[model samples]
Target: MAKQFERIEPAHREMMGRQAIFFVGSSAGDSRVNISPRSTTHFHVLGDLSVAYLDLTGSGSETAAHAKAGGRATVMFCTFDSAPQILRLYGRPRIDFRGSEAYAAFLAEHYPNGEPVGARQVVTIDLDLVQTSCGFAVPLFEHVGERPVLDRWAEAKGEEGLVAYRREKNTVSIDGLPTGLDEA
Candidate 1:
């Protein structure tokens, strides 16, 4: 069975803090939906009804594109090494570009180590519903460390390289929707 809530409770926030990876799903109108797995230590509980994460430069900017186009997004956190539970947050999301004030504010408030090397934007979600389900079928995986490949790639790219790469690869979503990355 599943349980639903109007806002995140304290226990739910604690569980979310323990999650190592989360999935972000989004769709804009009739465009193709995107579900991307993100592994980061840069998420924060803004409030009982709000959460945000730093968005790193990636091969696709579908989430950003969808959010910019007024799409709804769902963030899911599942237990892979502990209790069998899956929590889903349904909300309206927004993308704050790298140079924006919102991006800088998030960096200053949540990321103690400062902005991540490959950070491109901030994805903030204003939650309308939070659901939890028994994830009895989810497989258990031993905890490991974060992958260094993305950080290494971002360092190699530098600022200019990252911007160029975004232009070449992240400008448009798979369905040809502008991601707003080009403007950023």
Candidate 2:
């Protein structure tokens, strides 16, 4: 059986806290669906109906562009270790681009611990519905560690190199959508 709610309760927070990875969902009207498997830094529950995830510079900026276009997003979490529940958060997302006041504040709050690495934006989801279902079909997998390659590679690139990489690799959705490229 599946359970649904209006917002994230305390129990959902526990499930969120223990997970290593989750899938982010977004799309523009009639465009390709963007489902990203995110795993670098974990998300933090802002309140009963809010959640924030750091968006590191990845291959594509579809999630940011899609969310910015009109704030549509769905983030899904699955218990891959102990329990067997699938959690989906459907909401409108607010994106804080890098160097913005919001991003700076978040960094200050989580800082020294949340140092500014290759972060590009922060997507905060305002929950509209919370859905939980029996994840009987999901295969359980152990979380070994977060691969350091992204950070290492990003560092090696330096500032200019990262910008070039984003311009080359992260500026477009696979379906030829225009990604909001930073002019830096």
Candidate 3:
């Protein structure tokens, strides 16, 4: 059975906390829909109807571009171990670029240890709907651990390299939409 809620419930938050990964979906209407798998290490539930996650440097900036152009996003979490449930959050997203006060506050509050090497921005979502559904058809899998490859790669690139790389590759989406990286 499926259920819908206006806000995230305690059970939903608990489920989200236990998950090792989540998926983000976004689109710019004229562009391709972007779906990216993200680690939950930086995911934060700010309120019953709001959530935010640290956006890291990647090969592309599809999410940021889509969020900028459309302001809509969906984050999905599913249990791969304990229970069979899928939770989806539909919301309007705002991108707070690095160097901004809002991004600094988010980093201080949720990641006081210091920002990760590839940290780029904070993507905050003000959710409009929360949906839960049976995920019995989804197969279970064990989480070995988060891969260190990204961290290692970022460290190898160094800060300057990362900036150049972002300038060269992350400034545009696959469909040629501006990703707002230049402003970040």
Candidate 4:
């Protein structure tokens, strides 16, 4: 069975919080559609209709590019254990780059410990629709642990090297769309 709602209910928030990972989907009309799996380390449920996650340094900034190009995004979370259900949030995304005030404030509020290393931006979504469906067909996987590779790599790169890397690899999407990283 599938159900739809205009806002995230408490049960929905619980499911989102319990999920180990989520998938982000976006597209800029003619460009390639982007789907990326993200960890929940910095995922935040800001309110009934808002959510956000920290965007770390990655090979492609397609999500940011798509957001810049006036695209909507869908974020999906599924239970890998316990009851089987999948939740999808459809919304418009805003990217707060590393040095922006929004970014700093978000960090201060949601990430009291401190921003994770290699954090490139914060992607916030103002959700318009929330949907849930039975995820009976989705396979269950055991939780192992978070990989330290990214943190190690980012730590090694440091701030200067990270800026250089973002400049090199994140300025453009695979389809040649400007990712706005250069401006950040």
Candidate 5:
């Protein structure tokens, strides 16, 4: 049976900390839904009811666009190695662009390890509910390590290059929704 909580408990937060990857699901009204796999050591629990992740530059900006359009998002973290379990955080998200005071403060507070390069925005989720379920069908696999391709690509792009790239590729969603990247 699945369990639901109003806020994330300590055990739930611990499970999130151990995960190497997570999925983000979002959609705009009357538009196609999007579910994308995100990888990075960039996820953080801000409090019992708040969580945030640094979103690196990517080809699609659906999540940010949908969230900006007042759509809810679901973030899922699954255990691939130890016991079989899955955790989901459902909430509304706000995107803070790089160079904003909010973004800088968020980086300083949660990502003390240092923010990742190519980080275009910080997606902060204000939790409405938390759920945990048995991951009976989620196959077990070992986490080797984060792939370096993204970091390498970002470094090669350089700061100005990344800004231009975002303007070119990350300004709109597949379904023609504005991602607010123009303001970034």
Candidate 6:
């Protein structure tokens, strides 16, 4: 059986905290649906109703374009090391383009070092509902580490190089929607 919550309860939040990786799902109407597996130290829960993640520049800006087009995003965290449960948060995210008010506020709170490299905007999700499902069949795995190459590459590139990479690779969704980013 599946359990649902109007907001994130204490136990549910703890379950999410223990997960090392989460999946982000987003799409535009009548366009390709994207489900991406991401592992980064970029997510934080502000309250029972809202969560935010710093958007990093990478190939295919599906989440940004989709949310910009008024699409909802669902973030799922499944326990694959110890417990057997899957927690999903259904919400509509508001994108915070860099230099926007929301982005400034969020960065003020969480990113004192400035946005993460290969940076773009931020995605703040206002939770509508949270659901937890049984993960009896989900395989368990050991927690290893996040990818080191990209951060190292971005670091080596320095600030200007990172921006250049974003313009080259993260400017648009695969569907060609504007990702609210420019090279310079």
Q: Would you list the rank order by lDDT, best first?
A: 4, 3, 1, 5, 6, 2
Q: In candidate 4, residue 8 scores what lDDT?
A: 99
lDDT of each: 0.90, 0.82, 0.91, 0.92, 0.89, 0.82
* Local error of candidate 3 at residue 184 (angstroms): 2.9
Model 1 TM-score on a 0 to 1 scale: 0.96
Candidate 3 segments whose C-alpha is farther than 4 A from its true place: none
Q: Residue-wise lDDT of candidate 2 within 35-103, one digit each (tens)?
A: 889883647788899998888888888887786567489999999888799999999887787768888
lDDT of residue 136 for candidate 5: 91
Q: What TM-score would candidate 3 get against the native?
A: 0.97
Error of 6 at 120 (Å): 1.8
Residues 128-176 of candidate 1: C-alpha lDDT, one tens digit per residue: 9999999999999987888899999999999899988988988889999
Error of 3 at 144 (Å): 0.6
Q: Write the per-residue lDDT of candidate 4 for residues 1-184, one digit (tens) a residue.
A: 9999999999999998888899999998899889999999878999999999999998889889988888889999999988999999999998999999999999999889988899999999999999999999999898798999999999999999999999999988888888787787
lDDT of 2: 0.82
List ranges where model 5 is wrong by over 4 Å: 112-114
Q: All candidates' TM-scores?
A: 0.96, 0.91, 0.97, 0.97, 0.95, 0.92
Checking candidate 3 for backbone clashes, the offending pairs are none
Worst 10 residues of 1 by lDDT: 36-45
Off by over 4 Å in 2: none
lDDT, model 5, position 15: 91
Which candidate leads in lDDT? 4
Model 4 residue pairs with clashes: none
Cα lDDT, model 6, residue 134: 94
Off by over 4 Å in 1: none
Write the residue-wise lDDT of candidate 3 on 1-184 in tens digits. Answer: 9899989999999999999999999887878888999999989999999999998899998888888897589999999998799999999888898889999999899887999889988999999999999999999999999999999999999999998988999888999988787876
Error of 5 at 74 (Å): 0.3
**lDDT, candidate 2, residue 179?**
59
